[model samples]
Target: MKSAILQEADAEQFAEAGFAVLPGLYAPAELAALLRTVEQAPVSGPNFRRSQEVFAIRDMVGAVPALWPLLDTAALRQLLGQLFPTGCQLVKAIYFDKPAGSNWLVAWHQDLMINVSQRTDQPGFGPWTSKPEGVSVQPPVAVLENVVTLRLHLDDCDATNGALKVVPGSHRRGVVPAAAIAELTPEATVCAVPAGGVMLMKPLLLHASNRSTGNRPRRVMHLEFASVELPAGLAWREGKRLMM
Candidate 1:
């Protein structure tokens, strides 16, 4: 757990840059242990082709007691509270493994929608109605506002292993114009971090990753949090809440 003063500083950084990196958030041995647990999980079917190699563990706080220490860590809790003061709950947990030779490349886009469990034409639910086999729709602004993402690096991430690239202060703009983006400079700041470090980002921030050009694999644990209440009769599938 970090001190209150450190947590405040982290929150400020997140607000200014739309992201923050906390080094040594986890010990090397702790990270290695979680990585092993992730490796043992069953992989989804072939249709799960979103990322080159990815897996998800819902309610991970219950699955791995080791991670509970992280959740209870004062710094993390303060950051979460600062982001979602109302009381946020874990929405979903994902593991991304960018293997050598993987050609996966993510585009610059905002996490606009969240597919809840069962879909409805609820007020803040989506432009889409039902949850496709593996696809989900975007959630309303209320939901988006309550969300914060934590990405933990399991290996030393640099430009070679497809470290995340983000547009500084981009989150201040509600949405980016495609044509404007096309005309903008290609400059992007790389988020480089060593193993056991963590990156905290806003869901609306513009970010992406490229294919791994390095020999080693890049692994990350992405977790989302939301503080708002779920709609009536709807439950969050994984971290996705069902809207009424």
Candidate 2:
């Protein structure tokens, strides 16, 4: 399905609110196809997280090559171009499924870290860590400032279904201290999205989610894009640069 075009109002809203919802970005058929693909793919692995109520496919793009064509379609390329006019590349992608009975809850915080190919002693890049998916590092705020994350909702997401709660304009507070996160008093917004809608948010935005209390599952495909190239010797973990 064709992705929705990024409007000027969306750009303005993202700059001011740190996020913007692109309603009905994907057609119903597109969502159905994606769900089918997920069901058929051989994704069970160490990167895949499974529980009685929750299941997640981490590093989905890396795990399922067949999904690349759908993800890199022309419509999506155009949408990403609007956000990254200078040109951008895919950094990471993951699929999250929170079932009705899953007791999954994420606390309020910022996505301050990023995925890198390897760990190195780089100035301003610290708090390094490792994950089953890839190496993680806390890069400078400038790097994250240029990063945009698009979350495609496979199910209707609302407050009852684990929709993201974000502190609007928090992206402007570069590198907010963990202790100071609560100190920054700003009105939060619930990012409710439709089944085929998309939520565009900055990597530095302060956001979190609650456990689903609804009866249906809340599935989301999270894709992150960044235009900035890492310093020499440092590379993106996925490294699937878009040829835009």
Candidate 3:
């Protein structure tokens, strides 16, 4: 059952499973506002990807300032407080949609890269890659460990509609080599989230999704939060610098 309040057990579950789902984080009105804002986003832009199966805005926070009103709320703050008692900042945001009839399939992988403002020759950070989205680099394991990703669904999602399949405790293994993902995963559980639900997870968790077998649109706003300070001379991409 989903709770309107974020309880301590939610934090405990997340600590153990590396993921937790809080259903109905957004009310009807809030979700409607978000959908309306999404309709205004540019159909084609540098940060937008409109493939046959997938449509995504890599920098939703920067591209659409109207999203903040719908995203920032007391409920969100409560959830964040339970997980990060000290503090945390929203470091990244991406919005993606799996349209009906979409055949897009994502392979099992850990989100090990982070978007940063500059390429600092830090001792541990390296293997930088630049994309239209932003400059990305694989930070230290500790930095990735500190990341909290909140996936808010704009439509109902289930195993039939490209819901995420995750390895329960894989995050504890630290960063797994991408080259060794042949097994995809030994075991997995489908993360079924309702429309307006929010699923929180660790960036290190092993996750993948299959092509949608059902005819439902799956849209999500992927938000990443972190409190750790990047090594000197590094900062998050623009619009992710705010504390929420």
Question: Best-fitting candidate, measured by TM-score?
Answer: 2
| lDDT of every model, 2 decimals | 0.68, 0.86, 0.85
- Candidate 3 residue-wise lDDT, 127-244, digit = tens: 8998766699999999999999999999999999999999987889887887766554877899999999999899889999999998999999999988888866898875344443
TM-score of 1: 0.79
Better of 2 and 3 by TM-score: 2
**Could you tell me which residue pairs clash in candidate 1?**
88-227, 91-239, 113-138, 113-139, 114-138, 114-139
Q: Which stretches of candidate 3 lie over 4 Å from their true place?
A: 1-4, 179-184, 239-244
lDDT of 2: 0.86
User: Tell me, what's the RMSD of every candidate?
Assistant: 4.5, 2.1, 2.4
Where is model 1 poorest over a 10-residue stretch in terms of lDDT?
Answer: 46-55
All candidates: TM-score: 0.79, 0.94, 0.93
Candidate closer to the true structure by lDDT (higher is better), 1 or 2: 2
